[model samples]
Target: MPSYKLTYFDGRALGEPIRMILTYMGLEFEDNRIDMESWTALQKEIKWGRIPVLEIDGKEMYQSRAIMRYLAKQAKLAGDNDWEAYEIDCAAGTVGDLIDLYRSMWKLSDEKTKEEWEKKLLDEFIPSFMKNWDEQAKNTGFLANGKLSWADLYLHGWVETLEVLMGKEIVNEYPNLKLGREKVHATPGIKEWLAKRPKTVY
Candidate 1:
């Protein structure tokens, strides 16, 4: 088998897209999750002082987003032309914002703080993205290139992580977003991968 290794914590964080890509591709590799104590020690040992690194064929690649883009090309999910690739970039950037919003839950202590964050994200940020993606989806179900693209699955996996983190009913406001998510998640290869894959969280 082609050797690959992914290092991350339990939560989706930076490695979720990588995991989804691997699973969808049906590639077998090593998955390494670090405990708090070990995470701290390993921070000093790793080249970038970060987790969520991907080692493929013995070649180490850091930065989760970049790694995903590289592997997406290998998986033949990258778009056809530069214009199509631009859509992938935008979609990935948009998803990055959503994931950042989800991370806001970490330091929040009070229900008020959490609620405020959720309101801003769900009411404001998320709605804007929902509209944008809805328009995009109307043009083509895929994020771009009108086919299975990296951004398509990445956005799908991003929202899936959100649904798990936020709740299934959380996305009811955006039916198109929900439908788009379903289209990607229900893809033959992706659905099968999701079925047997590890359930790290919601």
Candidate 2:
């Protein structure tokens, strides 16, 4: 087995999709959670000033999206051809938009800002995302080829993270989105993987 290491902060953030790929594959890897100070200190030590760098067999890989696609390849979950891969990437990009939106609100540190953020997050962004993704899920079902792909798994992980962050069950509003989440999560590999999945407290 190839040795792997994923570095990130406490919350799910950029590294979660890679983690989910590793988990679904039941691959053993190191999870490095660094603090703000540690990230600042370690930035100079890595190839790039990024915390979400993935190291495999002593070679460092930067860029979260690239690392995720690589891990998906290793997990044999990326699509069959280049076009299919592009579709998978497109699906992942949709989730990326939602994640960025959540991150912006998550940065608020005050009661009023947080309250305003919570309202805006649920009222403005979340529902819009649900509508878009729900339609995509209904039409595409999976990211590419109507088969489970890296994008499917990442979508599941990103949605799960959103639910945790949102502090409520939100996907019920969209049946296709809910079904998509369940399909990826219920895959034999993913189901078995989730059973022994290591818990991360953040």
Best by TM-score: 1
True-structure RMSD for candidate 2:
2.8
Using lDDT, give the best candidate's number. Answer: 2
Segments of candidate 2 deviating more than 4 angstroms: 35-37, 106-114, 139-143
lDDT of 1 by residue, 130-173 (tens): 67777777644666655677776667765656767665555455
lDDT string for model 2 (54-158, tens) is 889878999777878887887777778888888888878877787788888768889899899889989989898778777777854665567788877777766
Model 1 alpha-carbon drift over 4 Å, by segment: 104-115
Backbone collision tally, model 2:
0
TM-score of each: 0.83, 0.82
Cα misplacement distance, residue 149 of candidate 2 (Å): 1.2
The C-alpha lDDT values of all candidates are 0.75, 0.77
